[model samples]
Target chain A: MQQLDNTFTALSDVTRRAIVARLADGEQSLSKLAEPFEMSQTAVSKHVRVLSDAGLVIVEKRGRIRHCKLDAAPMKEAIDWLKYYEAFWADKFASLTKHLAKD
Target chain B: MQQLDNTFTALSDVTRRAIVARLADGEQSLSKLAEPFEMSQTAVSKHVRVLSDAGLVIVEKRGRIRHCKLDAAPMKEAIDWLKYYEAFWADKFASLTKHLAKD
Candidate 1:
């Protein structure tokens, strides 16, 4: 749990979101994952660590390579919780549009 | 927005999540929302404020009573981001099930 909390909190940063987006393409080595960004590899590693803690990503070691792959379970839980509120917003936006049309 | 970051960070707490869950039922007054939890009204208010800052909740003051309503928009954004990974998880789970069945 606390790890889960930190995971989402860590991801609240746009940099982390961008890293996750890149990882979504396929598994990549830690160094490869760090390449596109200006941040230090250590910082990217920290972000990856947070993602791993959240269970959003799985990291595996083989020979000299450490590969990171996206893990979906925690993300599913997060999305489900978020979806409840998405419905609320959809309804509110619909009502607003309807009122605007009437006006 | 730093406010958005803080809002999600604030919501990572279970107590705040529970409060959001309660508010999802319908709009409720500040004290009424605070009553179910043993925490102080001030703490609950702080949670509500975070929710408001996150655009997850709308607070309106009518006389001395402040009503809180679920806002839903920021939640939609959060869910959309989470959903991308939800799909990633679904695919991974499907593959895992297939592999397990083969085994």
Candidate 2:
């Protein structure tokens, strides 16, 4: 779906990839996610928004804190699509080896 | 690799995805690849060049024909990376279901 596209597109950014990697450890507040990077909090917020929109992250407000947790559904879909293509390449590579051997 | 990044970024475009899908069938000359699309041959050429640089396609010149064939090496890497993330999600989802059942 369009959400899947947005998720993949957002994940394509290096900054967003790091955010997802951080969230993989455990849920963290918005400030904590932004702390390690030199980027401004506003920039980190935008990256988090992209991940949340992609369903890669779940954001919830508890008291005054915005906690982010990895959702993982969209990541699974992206991975499924990638795995299919990976199998295709494995076949292609095997054939390539055979073709080269025949030469 | 930077080339891999460029290839994935280029392929993120719908036009380039169409071009790669077309090249998957068999080797085709530059003009043949451009003919079906309403886009200019120059635009198609740019897409083809991006694919060629990504190592997704092999280009060889025989007479005036520039034939492009799917290379599949970089595609293998991208798919492999995606597969790893997909497995992570599967585990996360399984855990989520268990927690939900406990509720």
Query: What fraction of the genuine interface contacts, i.e. the true contacts, does candidate 1 reproduce?
Result: 0.68
Off by over 4 Å in 2: A1-4, A92-103, B1-4, B91-103
Candidate 1 docking category? acceptable
The DockQ figures for the candidates are: 0.45, 0.33
Off by over 4 Å in 1: A1-7, A92-94, A97-103, B1-7, B92-103
Candidate that scores best on DockQ: 1
lDDT, candidate 1, residue B94?
63
Pick by TM-score: which candidate is best?
A: 1
lDDT score, candidate 1, position B35: 95
- List, residue by residue over A1-103, the lDDT tens digit for candidate 2: 4654665576667777778767666679999999989989999998898788777888999999999987766756555544544543678667688358433
Comparing only chain B with the true structure, the TM-scores of all models are 0.79, 0.82
